[model samples]
Target chain A: MKEFELIRKYFSERGPKRKDVVLGVGDDAALTRVPQDKLLVVATDTMVENTHFFPDASPRSIGHRCLAVNLSDFAAMGAEPAWASVAITLPTSDEKWVEEFSNGLFEVAEYFNVQIIGGDTTQGPLTVTVCLKGFVPENKALIRSGAKSGDWIYVTGSLGDSALTVASKLNKINVKAEHLEQAQRKFNYPVARLAAGQVLRHAATSAIDISDGLIQDLSHILNASNVSAEIDVANLPISQAVLDSLDEDSAIEMALIGGEDYELLFTVPEEQKGYLEQNATAMGVPFTCIGQVRGGDSGICLVKSGQKYPLPNLNGYQHFSSEEN
Target chain B: MKEFELIRKYFSERGPKRKDVVLGVGDDAALTRVPQDKLLVVATDTMVENTHFFPDASPRSIGHRCLAVNLSDFAAMGAEPAWASVAITLPTSDEKWVEEFSNGLFEVAEYFNVQIIGGDTTQGPLTVTVCLKGFVPENKALIRSGAKSGDWIYVTGSLGDSALTVASKLNKINVKAEHLEQAQRKFNYPVARLAAGQVLRHAATSAIDISDGLIQDLSHILNASNVSAEIDVANLPISQAVLDSLDEDSAIEMALIGGEDYELLFTVPEEQKGYLEQNATAMGVPFTCIGQVRGGDSGICLVKSGQKYPLPNLNGYQHFSSEEN
Candidate 1:
């Protein structure tokens, strides 16, 4: 089938229906309405073959993960996911591949009520770059630069499962088949903490989505807000899949440096911690307080027992700079 | 240099200044404020080596062409270009290539006051996908579906220059060195007809950017509005370079179906033709009326010397569909 035909057949009508989309696909561009008093939050992420996923990875996973990562950015900002446009480069004309890819993409998009408003398609190596537009009410958007001294750092959901799957794929770790599969699910389909993000919009002082490793991404908040952090290593959220597979130290390392978790790392005033924890439990989002903001030059340190340890590495998945990913 | 270093060192802090960007680059995303009463107009285009440009094409030209093509979409909609996000894939981390590419991209962007808000860089086959966000006053965006019967069809600038360059490069046409260079300039650095589009916002009934040849793109407007067109081939704005390089017949055919000119193809109500014509000249944008919209089923035909002719193929450089370009 022709590429345009394939696009209309597979991608054009998928995702949640939208009201503010004045014009959708098939036009030269998409026209959408921006509501008054709401600020638009835009984020884009590119996933390339091998660099971001495996060649044999399910096309559905590829589609899901590409859009999923971008949605996580909106989640970090406490924004409502609205619309998206994708530019997909495919090496060959593969009908089934595009079908499954669109299905996967729309599945996640529909889950968040996001509409796929427009896109561009080209022939090349498989790569998907997606840009999402969301909205936050005026003066209510969460930002990384709002953390201050006396704020308590917290993270939603357990970390390291996604990175554990990568280790399993590379044979760097040994685990039971079922356990590895569970971790793989987390790796392939990690959910963005949108509910937690919204709840934290007013409760949290600052926030960032952990695509980079936890400590490394937390440093961004510290730097942006001109504050420091002392994270209690023992308080880190350790998933059962990770704990049952690896020893404490390995699990901790993976939790610290494991990337692609899509979890929300946030800070709240110490006074709000009491209600924030209760509210998170009520909302069914796991919340763990793992650190405290400190008054000082911007930096991050780990607290183990009573001793402060310097960070191992502050960079995560930086292209060409570090080979960690 | 690694990809991240290349992005920060070369592509960062370029382009025209934009004050609406609350957060630009360096983070997981970019945040920009859209004015209260304006609708967001967005378009995305992807350029892949061997598919959209030659592998040996100048990095500068390649950069300029990718963004220029996207801006053409904004021009088609009569929107104000505001910001852009790029997902660039390079075969390797070449500092010089990145430098030249940034120079070309920023040159066009700054001219239109479009800011580089955020982007991703990675190792892969060379591909550039850019998404532009623009603004249009509510209810004022020009669309392809607004042309009515009796509207005069017009196009800005000459056609087939870029395609002529392609023909020259492929040895399909022979031209003097100066003519070939002039054609190459058109091919490499075609300008988006923004000024004309803005002047036509209220004057023109419908509009589209001619990236994929005149006939192929005009068909979009015709199909969208459920109308047909009678374009006079003799009236097409054929450049002297194209005429000198090819026979008159071949030049007309190229103008009919050759792609990637980056000009505006629009329609004006007969009543407003007087205002549109005078305003276009005042805006320093060439306007040529070549046809008229007619009441009929969606289709297009060409006329030369008062004789109706069958339309040539109307498909543009569609991926895996047309081999015209």
Candidate 2:
């Protein structure tokens, strides 16, 4: 009937069992044992209704997206997600909505073996803030600053699909039925490449998960590592949905500026290129070489049809600012 | 600048250097190393505009309260506060508000040596959600279900000040100048009682932080331990602000039903009573014995001058529900 009571009934008591969770929901805090040899990985993300998602967004998809985004962070670091805490606010106490939301949350959590541990439920506009924790071996965590000149840049899975999903959802573009379905699935439940991330731990020189557009997110690695990048536009991984709905130039533009892909963008040194490709493929996640880390202070270029152009000055979908891109 | 750029400038680059933070806030996720012998403690709390704070409330205070509440959860679990991630949503990108918020957050964080690890900044109605991670020794973490009959119930710090602050701020009651200042401090920056929690790990049989009022929160401990408790009204720790503003009956009611004290409510076995008192004092936190646990399937009682009274059919400050208390 009340917030706490409803939470314990639907979330706490029903949460999947995990041996490492020494304590779960209902306590002031959840206690979990971290394996001694690993470092703890933490990331938090918030999804605001009408801002991050449509007002009519399915509770399940919203829930899945909230956790998937956080898992994407772990994926970038080559970490295995272990636990999660959610602080959700709602305008009203609708039991059905709450159930659906938790169902969506638990669905992805269960699939990933991430335990839903502790969080607060409050009254307000609908917002879901999820904080996830995972672990990686000491000194082995992938970092953006490790990119080096001569490293081969790679990304997991195709890009532009999620961006196309948003475009189609807004009716800004016309997509075929199958393309729409494919876009919607990618839009709602873009999988986190956990296994591929783990495999890249030893192979990739540096890594980041693509939440912002490929261009903007890649620039972070360039800025952090003090290196530039040369992306072969033709080599960009274009999703079939986008390929079917848009021209080559528009799809490439979408891949560069469109975000929410939750795919890993990483760099591997020349010597480890073969190792990374083989391992990523064996993990059953697609891997594509898109660019090369170059020896420059700070610049990015797009090479297409034998011409090189400076990277577009478009900013990705930054949540709380202008949307000039 | 975008949300990410603003965050990097104000929150990340400016965050204190903490050794346990293997990698700080620029990566997809922050990496932290938990001590080998301890289990990770996690809790999340969100402060929503209007529901949790006034629209014009001080940003610094809001920031302080967000982390303080999460730290309170750690205190109840006998965990050492360590790292925190904040997911803050804003109606717009106001640089002044962002700076002040980070100031308040870092102020409290620095006091406890806690690290500001990672989080997301987004556009939406103003909301602050904080997720904290602490560490508690394996098998020594306190829980509500550990209480036993005959255990002495104790609470740390004075209570009802925060409630008085809310009442005075809303014009429901009048508090004197000095008392208002005291109440405001308690309202915005209640201490987490971390040291007291650590000491209690060796002495307290069960513990919980007082959040959703004394009566209801204590009932959680009773229900979990399959026991009941009787609180002597005279022993309830009333703050000067509350005493100055309300009559004895109302003050007692506030103490029982006005939550958000962020103080520890704990039970110590008969033999460990002296140990708790001595250690709590040594840790510079006051402790008062308010009641005794009793063997029962489910019940709570109140004692006035010597007579046992049935626990009031009163509800505390439950969000998204009736306000009949």
Candidate 3:
């Protein structure tokens, strides 16, 4: 365990230092101050080897994606990420592995202005858990239960690229050389859509990050809001990389049910639509309207090119399943 | 997959509902409020199977001990624990295992008035990570750096019982039948001296929880305060359970360097010693003055019956060590 000491040194010395952090990293606990008018928001996510990623996955990507996923959750709630606590369990404390992992982790931490306050590093099978804390203005957090029946459903950025990347690696689909890099980048280095979420806090009725695919996550909003939704498969945002790798139905299916896309899925009411469209540039991401919210509790109904689309047999990634998709 | 839903349902429906939690468990992130006059305290601890516990360690004990260790960190800081985010990675979703684990977790949460705000559950090797958030009055935290020369060194409660239990399990010692259950309980359900920590916040110059043993943890205070210490081995507060199971020398060794005791090791200036003694009843634990802080950084100097005592050979528990002691 000298590695333990080294690991602590690596974390304590690196990363952004926030003024609100009265103390950071070295003590039994870190002490911080939250602004008086803001509510603290907390989100946690865990990635496991052979379950969330491949055994040969790059340490950098693992580090980046684990924190990215949690930040995306804060984004969904329109929270400004402030601090993070990471718990990493690995089989060995390989110095090079930890170095690269820290690089990937601190890169995002610095960019998001999130201070790595405290964490634990233990020896075990590879697993990374990040708990993110942020702040949202009082009564300003976007939540699933707030969606109304007449709101227009929208998504930020393109989807399916990350899922397509996973499919390519599993040999379920073959990706072209020109498109492979884009797909891999989309999967490994996801943008959390923080700016868009902040923009949506004023205009959107409800919001959720697309972690468990569009349909599954939209179902969560529908369930919470007691409303139904109709998503137009033809209008689903699919990147060129996804279109080139698979057929139309396959691309649509990937966008609807494949997981790990960190884009925001949100709904805007009729009165807020103009406000959203007028300030589109402020969102920092392209937005597309894919459907509309409907009355009642019928769940999600799919439509494509003016026709009803059949639901796919496969579901979004189920974490506890014996096998990964 | 459905088990994931069931697991989520279990956590969302149980635990103490706290007024400070604006939103918890079901959303992308939990929302909480921190009182204006307090600084937020954050601590994280992870427990991995085979490393932190045996394969057959009860699910209930695992859950309780995992959160207990983190809460102990809060206790050391004299913080009022408020919220927690738990990330649990397991090989399978055994209903009984999860049920018992939740029971144990909720038991501590309810007792401490800490709410389970958010968490993630994933499939992997058995591991549990807990991140706890609390509040402390500004500048009132008992940090390790405040110990001063000539300060009285004190420890709350008895030590070595937890370590003796581990030694017995490893066949290094034989525990008397009368003391076996007490030793196991002390190891499994070690109490965090929250009340004592609060009392010391006003009087003690520095403090730390004894997760890493008396010598190792006391060294932390010495190093941070840039001061040395003389610990009287004869005055160590060892439990009857420890004394009954081991010889005098072995018992002292265990008390000096064994880990997981979770008692408070603190230093009080000469001026505050009277205040501390007068508030001993409010501390809610028996405390012993076992040593005194010295000027300069010569590290810890051990003494027994007024003669210099040799340091023990064993070191405290290191998380990344290959073999458990």
Candidates arranged by TM-score, highest first: 3, 2, 1
- Could you give the CAPRI-style class of model 2? medium
**Which candidate wins on lDDT?**
3
Instruction: Estimate every model's Cα lDDT from 0 to 1.
Output: 0.82, 0.84, 0.86
User: Which runs in model 2 stand beyond 4 Å of their true positions?
Assistant: A313-317, A321-325, B321-325
**Candidate 1 chain B lowest-lDDT run of ten:** B316-325
Q: What does candidate 1's lDDT look like per residue over A1-325, in tens digits?
A: 8776777788776667799988888787888888778877888888888877878899999989988888888888888889988888888889989889988898899889988888787788898888888788878888889999999888988989888888888888887888888888877887878888788877888989988688778877888899998888889997788888898877887888888888999999978877786686653578888989998975877878888755565353554421111
> Model 1 in CAPRI terms: which quality?
acceptable
Tens-digit lDDT track of model 3 for B235-269: 99998988887889988988988888899999999
Model-by-model DockQ, in order? 0.48, 0.52, 0.54
TM-score of 3: 0.97
Q: Any runs in candidate 3 off by more than 4 Å, and if so which? A: A315-317, A321-325, B315-317, B321-325
Predicted candidate 3 versus true structure: per-residue lDDT over A1-325, tens digit per residue: 3754666667888999999999888788989999999999999888999988899999999989988988899889988999998888889878788888888899999999999988888889999888888899999999989999899999999989888888889998888988999889988889899999899999999999988888888988999899999999989889899998788988888888888888999999999999999989999999999999999999888988788999886543554631110
Candidate number achieving the greatest TM-score relative to the actual structure: 3
The digit string of per-residue lDDT tens for model 2 on A1-325 reads 7776788777887656889988788788888999988899998888898888899999889988989988888888889999998888889888888898888888888899988888878889889888998899998999889999999999888989888988988899999998889888988987888888888899988988888789878988899899998899989988989998998788888888888898899999999977875675665688889989999875788898769845555744454621110
TM-score of each model, paired residue for residue: 0.94, 0.96, 0.97
Error of 2 at B215 (Å): 0.4
